[model samples]
Target chain A: MQRSRLGDLTAFNQLVERYQGPVYNLALRMLSYEAAAEDVTQEVFLSAYRALGQYREGSFKAWLLTITANACRDLLRKRKRRQETSLEEMVETSGDRSVSPSPTPEEYTLRREVQREIQQALNHLSHDHRLAVLLVNLQGLDYGEAARAMGVSLGTLKSRLSRGRAQLREHLLTARGTREP
Target chain B: MFRRRSEPIRHQRVRELLSSYLDAQASERERELVERHVATCEACRRYQEELRDTVQAVRGLPQVTPPRTFTLAQAPRQRMAWALPSWGTPLATATAAALFAVLILGEVTGLIGSPVAHPTAMPSSEALSLKALVQPEAAPEPTPAASDALESLAVQDETPPAATQELSRSSADTSPPPPEEAAQPPLQVPLLPWLQGALGLLAVASGAWWLRRRRAIR
Candidate 1:
């Protein structure tokens, strides 16, 4: 952290390498577009590099996740403005994924199906609720860390997380019902 | 009747607590209430299990690898390029306007591009020849000899040539020449306006650039 703050590029790149997966996944889950997620991920790292000076003592991963969340939100806002698409509309349009021809084995297919179902459920969530759930469950952040990342109080984070979980539970159950014999 | 009515409200409260309890984020009292309710209520137990499954499914989602490396190709600049404050455009505009006003004032006050003052004119064609010779166009580059000749002309303008001739003849080398204002190079005057104009244009360009950047951000 010290070396990066002193303008050491290599040190900052190391931080990028370490946190890129979590950052990229967070962006991917939040934005739900592969290209935009990649863009937001790149934006997040560059933003973190420039803002290294302002980072005080805390979880660096949480801080980077905060940047990632903010970048995703900004892009989502722009996307909303340009397309004027609401979240519910996006979920309805994008939730159903047609199964691709699986060159991979059965386990991979099953996993992909499960992943798709969860991503659809996440997509169905409101922006704030989705972020709260992702930060805590997907990213494995503690309540405090998730709260910091979401810029909400612990109470608010829990509230959103609870609502988000309830919605996800309903969606997943419906998905399961359709899939079952 | 009270038990049936209160059961639904208790069920609702317990469902809320189950989410936090699953994450181990519930308070001790809330956890105990949820556990006590779920131990007997089949519906609440199923809700807790389903909520837990939802959280686990989300957590189980595979971490997608980034399509490509996100490391910046080059070291970032010292600061965010767009970190300019809202007043940046106005400040640049004000600076440009102030410099423009200064340049205009300079031209209006005759401070810039003013010809050097000729203190006195001799009553002869010698002064006319000197004036013609010293025209900036004719003598674009002033030489030392031209200034010295002008100085001598000024001395002659104040004291008649005949009297200087008599004085020189009487006191061979005793009398000193009178003091005169030094001639200023005309090159300096025209350069001032160009410099100020360049500065004003630079300021205007930067102001425009800042305005465009701010709009793009919005």
Candidate 2:
């Protein structure tokens, strides 16, 4: 970090510990594979360490997410080569997998269906569009931060999200065999 | 189908501020603009809801807590800050400086000569050496004072011959001032040039030295 105050490993580690969940979550959604997401997350932190000196004030998180996004992209390219994605190998990380005392069978089935569709829709997207959708819609980043995280201008962020969301909508609709809006 | 009204295809250019904005990244202006547009624009509003659903779906993605936090405190790769010890830099700088001075002073003074010469001692050869070590020694220092007024006059005035002739004439016309005084003027004449040349060289060398020191500090 440019600030000498955060120059030590302790501070850097703190950042890793604090933001890892969100960063990993974002990567998981974009990459759609548990292992690849974790790998990308590690690569992102490694990159963040290498680029720590270049870190400017007030943009640390944006800078970090940008790295995370790029790492996701690289993994995607590597995945294309194998033609066998590691998606099925992913350990199910259902946050709410524990039996609920008051869950109706319908709700459980609906959630399971939604999860499958979400994963399918995300995988269907281009990296740019997937990342745009993940950061803005799920990660709750604004256009500017998402744009920054994606290392794009605000316009590009909007375009990707627009296209990405549209694609996602189409995928969800088709999966449900519902009429297109 | 979406239709164009007189309102002119009014829709938020941003259907939804992407998911990252949820973490408080948007400027107030952006939040307000998106808020207002989503309120009035059905297309953007619907997109916002869908965007929300999509993001929520992703969030609900199975959380794969890797068996370990992959980033376990693998000792941080050594950084330049750590690789370069605090004291090591100053030592390196000092060694570099010593080498730089040796090389430069060598070129100027024909190598292995006296490291520095006094201004009033012998300035003629010293000034030439400056143009010689110009690369390392061009930094100028404030001149303490003019070293030799007479030598300066000699080089600047182009009257060395006339000065010599006058000295000869004075010797022939009058009895030399007492031995004590006779030795004084002659001694003073040579020193004037030596002083001037020395001062100039010192000024040039000091300036160069100052710059080197400054750069080392950085």
Candidate 3:
């Protein structure tokens, strides 16, 4: 962090390489689109690079994820304003929906199907709930760290996480039942 | 009464604590309490199962590698770009202040003449008349015979004879005699423009130095 603040490009790039997966994953889950997630991931790093001076001592991962969340919210707002669509509508209309490649075509199809279902369920949640789930469940941050990232109280974070998980469970179960029948 | 009103809140709090307990995020005491409560509470037990499943499903989602390296180059250029606004704001303000000072100096030194000053160009004649109007003691006294003659002329003209004669006599006595004092040029301070210019140059130089130091550090 000290070297990065002192304008060392190598140090900053090292930090970026270490955290890009988690940042991109957070963006992916928050946005539900591959291309938008990629764009937001890049933006998050660039913004973090510029604001390196303001970085304080703590979990660098939490700080970077906070930036990712804010960037995703901004893009979501822009998408909302442009199309006046709800989160569900935006998810449904998303372009270039793809997952990381699997070894077998059949496995890839199944994995993509499950990912799409989860993404849809995630999109069904309110922004706060979705963020809480992504930070805690997806990004693997603890309750306190997730709360810090979301800028909410610990109780609020737990509430949102609980609600978000319940909603996701309901949707995933319903989807499974429909497919099986 | 208060406990009755807060009963629902307490129940919700317990449920949330139980949710945390399922995730292993609750304290030992809270975990024991939640465990005890969930054993008896059918709805909470169901909620706990749902939360567990939700977390499991989320964790089961695929994590993807980044498509490409997000490594950044052009460190100096990017740093400069960010530095622009931080350095630019105060420099812009200083430039504005310098321009304002120059404009004021220009007006003061008559390089940019004012409208009020233009009307007062023939200062000698205007000054003499103002002096005469303002100094009644300097005027000569009116003669008795002259006042009597003017009174007769006013009566023939059928005006307020005595009052008209007194006003005429006073005007004639107080009318300024010309060409007594020579016109003097207004005072000019030679140091003013030089001082303003030096100050403006100093501000610009300091601002440039500050920006240069910022760029070098980056």
Candidate 4:
């Protein structure tokens, strides 16, 4: 990112080509709506472009994801302003419409159940906690990487992730067998 | 939360280090220390299991590739931006050129009469006298009178008064005049353009920045 900001278009392109897929996937996981996720992905990259001059020599992906998390938060805030929500709000949209790879019947059931539980639990979390949880848990970021991606200190990241995971665990446990697989 | 240990050791730092420990990122010495402590600490061991489980649950989420037809691959390539204000940006480069031209013209026609471009520069007494006569402007006062005058000027506009009406108005103007000292606003000569050409360039550059910001918002 630093190289790109220093008048290296090739370096910027290299970053895009390298991280586009994973970033899109992260957005997809966090947002659940393909179109919204795609929009967030674009917003993430656009934000990175504007902030490229501030890039330090470190993990580029972490910075990119932090911006992506911010974009998702903005979208969520916009959604809140509409006084609307997912299907429960009767907003006329279905959830989990973007699961990848054709799943077998059994796999589909488990995936759907997991998806619904996770998404609902995610909605229940505070924005920062959800972001930390998503990056660390769903995106396979270690605490350090998650901290970098969240623009938080490692301790803060761990606290949020642990609290988030505990909440998700509680939510999942409360929903035990309530969702048919 | 305070539980005394038979073998006293640091605890909060160790708990915080659990984040790094779970990720296998702790230094060898730190890792060894944490592992040894965990051996005697049931609470810490359970805490580590919980973190491990949470990590697993998150990792288990389906990596849903967006429905292929709904890819953001169509997302417009974000073009690199400049910090130039659109209207003011051109004024910068043009400013340099224009100022350069003005400076050159002033130098070229200093005392000599250039027939075509500067036939008017030959009046020595005129140039020196105008230079002498131009006085610096003082700052304007912020008074109710000026505001009221501006307001009155705005309000009583464009109606032709009848003769009897004018007579009535003139008759109503019998009040004594307020002090003249309060009426005039001081002249304010802006020193911005002459401050620094480089600063003007910088301002143009800032305008370019503002312009890009506006563009980005759009």
lDDT agreement with native, every candidate: 0.74, 0.59, 0.71, 0.60
Winning model by DockQ? 1
Number of clashes in every candidate structure?
A: 0, 30, 0, 6
Error of 2 at A83 (Å): 2.6
Q: Using lDDT as the measure, what is the rank order of every candidate, best first? A: 1, 3, 4, 2
Residue pairs in collision within model 1: none
> What are the per-residue Cα lDDT tens digits for candidate 2 across A1-181?
4342345666667778767777787787776666777787787776566556555555566667777776776676787787874654453445453233435889877766677677777778888888887776666676777776666788777667767776887787687775234
Docking quality tier of candidate 1? acceptable
- Which candidate, 1 or 4, would have the higher TM-score against the true structure? 1
TM-score of chain A of each: 0.88, 0.82, 0.88, 0.79
Model 1's TM-score against the true structure: 0.62
lDDT of 1 by residue, A11-67 (tens): 888899999989988888897777777788888888788777667777999998988
Candidate 1 reference-contact recovery: 0.58
> Residue-wise lDDT of candidate 4 within B40-77, one digit each (tens)?
88877786776576567667666654443222333234
Among these predictions, the greatest lDDT belongs to 1
Better of 2 and 4 by TM-score: 4
Identify the runs in model 2 with alpha carbons over 4 angstroms from their true place.
Answer: A1-7, A86-106, A178-181, B1-67, B70-72, B79-218
The per-residue C-alpha lDDT of model 2 at residue B127 equals 41
lDDT of 3 by residue, B106-158 (tens): 77766543222233444354444433443344455545665565556556776
Model 2 alpha-carbon miss at residue A46, Å: 2.6
